[model samples]
Target chain A: MIPDKAKELQERNLKYAQIIQDAMSGKREDMEKRIKELNLASTPKEVIHSETSIKLYRFIPVKKKLHKTPLLIVPSLILRYYIMDLLKGHSLIEHLVESGIDTYLIDWGIPGDEHGHLTFDYYIDKFLKRAVRKVSRSTGVEKINILGQCLGGTIGVVYTSLYQEEINKLVCLTTPVEFEDAGLLSVWTDRKTFNIDKVVETFGNTIPADFIHACFQFLDVKATVERYKKLYNNVLDENFLYYYKALDQWINDKIPFPGEVFRKFIRDLYQENLLVKGKFTINEKVADLKNITCPLLNIVAKFDHVFPEKSAKALNSFVSGPVDYHIISAGHVTLVVLFPQREETFKLISDFLKK
Target chain B: MFMDPAQFGKNFMDPTEFNKQFYGQMEQVFIEKMNEMIKNPAFLSSISKGVETGLDGKKKSDDLIKKYLEKMNMPTREDTSKILQYLQKIETKILDLEDKIEDLSDDLKNLKKEYGKSRKTEKKK
Candidate 1:
């Protein structure tokens, strides 16, 4: 007990000395410059197709061991796509490319008023179909793999249900499928209180990014404060500074949720819990999850605030495919944010894809 | 047990980073007691209303900014969107051409198959 106290005191003194030395060093200007100069999406990519609100990029392969089936990454409409392609050693795109996986990413660019009118039909039916066709035609392969993140997984699951023949496999990471959990976001977006039609009518084109970001920040005020706190405390450490700046860049880069998609997502999925019910229809056809016959790899996090375990486990219900579930110690973005978590997640994905 | 070294440090320093055990215990001792005193339902109701009001304020400020930029004749997202509208029109035309090309390819394949069938029939005759 005495030795433990001495060790604790010594550790405390060391931390204080580190903090004081960092403070005394001219790190203020250095930190400011680092924050301002930080850039993201470092992996080399060629825009294979570009449309109004979407830019489909094919990441240049780093090795010659190319696979026949290509992989397309579709992220949620909530933010920019650069979070997946952050930097050299930390990028999922880089890892996939180096591992000889032909990778493509869909950049849902700034949603305009026109995009506001686009529903899952337009995304799943029109945009995704075209993107898939473009990739398949370019590669001379009919079926390709898709790994969708968050709401993008919902889009993938729905698309696979409808157009199973077109896709080789489906991957969902931290995908929120059911609204059974009484999480704060779910409770807040409850139809009884949060009227979707009214929000659409009021906001017109899109739910402003500022509003969405504000709500996200409101979820864990403590976490946000702690992030900056850690950054400030480790201001002198170049490695920590780089990591924080990369993540901070992604956290700030967000686009407004398109109004039409937001309305349907909130009403049908969030409010009515429609996706898992085999009742939801995109493009005037039934999107029964049972119709997904391809291989499925569902990666759910244990403590996903946005998509809690109980909510994300709804994938086990009516999936007629070979379902592989992987639960990890992570939050929503930790799969890409933390280095070890990102490495493990990507390795799992690569192995699963190859298998 | 969901922890990293940094997270362990944070939770040790900040109660906000409370572990499951600590959270349950602290809730009873602190957060829950505070909630009981303030009535969390009423507190959350006010916070929710405040958030809605905050979002509304943001929307209004956005509209104001749009108008201000328009008045100044400065290029804005609206202008870029207008240009993209024209680009979309062209993209649609390109897609139409692609459809036509696909149809032509199908026609060529059919013609080749018919030619082969006719040659076989002639050989049989």
Candidate 2:
């Protein structure tokens, strides 16, 4: 090796040795304490409606000139609602509220034993519908806008299809519509390979959060390993450390997907691909995507492993309204977590809602 | 600009760089192989079978416990779950009542506004 290269290597080695020495000096203990005290989901909000395990929150607006039509954000049932309002400054909810969009969120709280019997129909009809009605009634507007992410987006699409007249605009963030080519999840939930009924029967009420976490972790073990590597490399970066710890906490904070809802979601959407086929039903009402005539904004992640871009973009072909389709260069989680992509996505959503 | 193969190899022979490249390739290969294995039909079937067998054993043991608890006149998970379900049903009924009452109240307010508007219109005439 060249002399300069050798010297650079020597310095890097010394740096590593110092980092190890710091680790031995209980800097890690301080990090652990700081992580424990890390405040997340810090945006101020009030519970506007509560039923069973679900709570609908209306964020206290920071701006005076609010939009006429209120915006309701629906997150995946399996994940916490805080992913949207993750940090005070770096939050989608905060951005929307600051932009003067009256915002509401459906927090699908940790399900209990009794919540296992809760079906998809109940979630769509009762939980989502009630949340929408509350937002609409409270805002005194007949029409409202909805922004849903992942599985929540699927629920929003169905809800908008059933109640298109009451929806002014619909935004879907990386929502899988054509599950036939959705990705590994579709393959894993195949009827021939997997026994959904038996699994539901065994678990009884709600699928444990750990089981879901394990499955997701199993999806990309290399990615999980690389995440730790990144965290290690950025140990000295306070900003990076804060964001990483916050995201790490959110990812680990898992919640059970109610049993019957899981069964139906896998069977109908993942296995059968019913929603795009216009055969999926909620409470005896067919949720045909063509019924969604409101202006639709579908944002899909180009590099999403969970829901492939093609699968998410399939919403555009079905919706009757004019579609504003965008495929951003980001992964499923990174679209919301990362800076540049997150900012772009927020701008797209806020601009769409402003229209 | 000419260089011998041995000298070129030596030039690139840093242990740190070698380790990074080797591990990067290994990670790629591992991920590719694992994804392929996971997508295999036989692999999926095997996993399903393992899960089903494990769950079956658990179910059998849980049944045994339930029987013993019943003999001791103690409530099992089923008993508690049934009661919870009943309470959820009652809660649903109450919510339904609340919804109906809200709708009626809105209608009453609308009727009162219409009546007040008609009386004012008659006075204007």
Candidate 3:
């Protein structure tokens, strides 16, 4: 009788397993089809004025009037800049433009073997600083409003700290100032376990896609799985599929972080927690947060799993600027994209910059 | 257990009485759980913290619910529980692997030291 009961349980379990497997396979097929459709549908627009090194994609403001200072958007190195300007309705870039803000976004080109030796100082001092100078010179404005998202936010903060005179206003979205408080990513990147030298040596300027994917997976393993399942179920709708594809493309669009820059980032920020401790040194000169004296606006996602509120809030203590910090009731991406008009986040940012 | 309509009518002519009896049992269960929560300081603290953090959004609420369910000694949802268990196992495995790597590193260091000593002796000879 006991053997019969055990066999019955085994059969039931096997049936359940089969059901899950079928569901997963169906979901995968739907997702792949949707992805292919999206790739076909997407129209890649070329920049009106393209430079040799960086391509400038311009999205003119919907309203004829422009804000006093032209806003420059800097997205993270891990993902594409289009995530900020995803779709017309859900796009932060569109909303900003419609609200009469002059915006220009920098698309950090994918790094090559030549960029392997590029250090953090090069990014902050050379690329970003040079970009700011060029923009300022072109616009004939002494100072330009600068905004950075994710890792770009970190770079923005570093830039602002070092060269506050060049920046009129600074805004950071979901930026991590205190690396020690940055949760799993911080712990994982710490010196003891991370052999960055081997990775840089092997891959040159580019870190493997698997490594980046693994870091994101570690953030929320269940959500990562469930998100695709949900996407699969909703793949029939063209609009939903477009949004999913845009998001998927942006998510999978991993850029090779210049090895030397990455090395400095991990060593200075994660290993030493130098930014918050006020010990970060740039070009043998200390990059002190106290040096930043611009009007600062720091927007943090209340429910950000990747960059926690604590990590973002650490900037409050470090910066000597006229700072205003607001916690938006959205996740990292939604904090910028969703409810672009209704949410007080956009209005607050606009008002700050306008002043 | 079939009751005659006349007998049933006679037993409880009022619907209020039946409802009172039904809800009285539910009230007792609710109070018992509440009492259990209050008695345990850790459970109480966790519940309060959960409520505090629950204000963030859906993700925070879900996390709070999961934590609350664990604290209440209730069965967790299958997917959530499975993922949590898998993560715990992975974390443990990673720690173990790191320990082994550290040990191997130490062994290598000692081996290198011994080789250096042997080479010095060979040079002296």
Winning model by TM-score: 2
- Chain B alone, candidate 2, TM-score of 0.72
User: Tens digits of per-residue lDDT for model 2 on A309-328?
Assistant: 98988999999999999988
lDDT score for candidate 2 against the true structure: 0.84
User: What's the lDDT for candidate 3?
Assistant: 0.68
TM-score for each predicted model, relative to the true structure: 0.78, 0.88, 0.63
iRMSD value for model 1: 6.4
Shift in Å, residue A144, candidate 2: 0.5
| B-chain TM-scores per prediction | 0.55, 0.72, 0.40
lDDT of 1 by residue, A25-110 (tens): 43335434533467567788899988776889998987888987999898898877777877667888888888899999888887
Position A94, candidate 2: lDDT: 88
CA RMSD per model (angstroms): 8.0, 5.4, 20.9
Instruction: Report DockQ per prediction, comma-separated.
Output: 0.14, 0.44, 0.01
True lDDT of residue A318, candidate 3: 77
In angstroms, how far off is B86's CA in candidate 2?
2.0
- Docking quality band of candidate 3, CAPRI definitions: incorrect
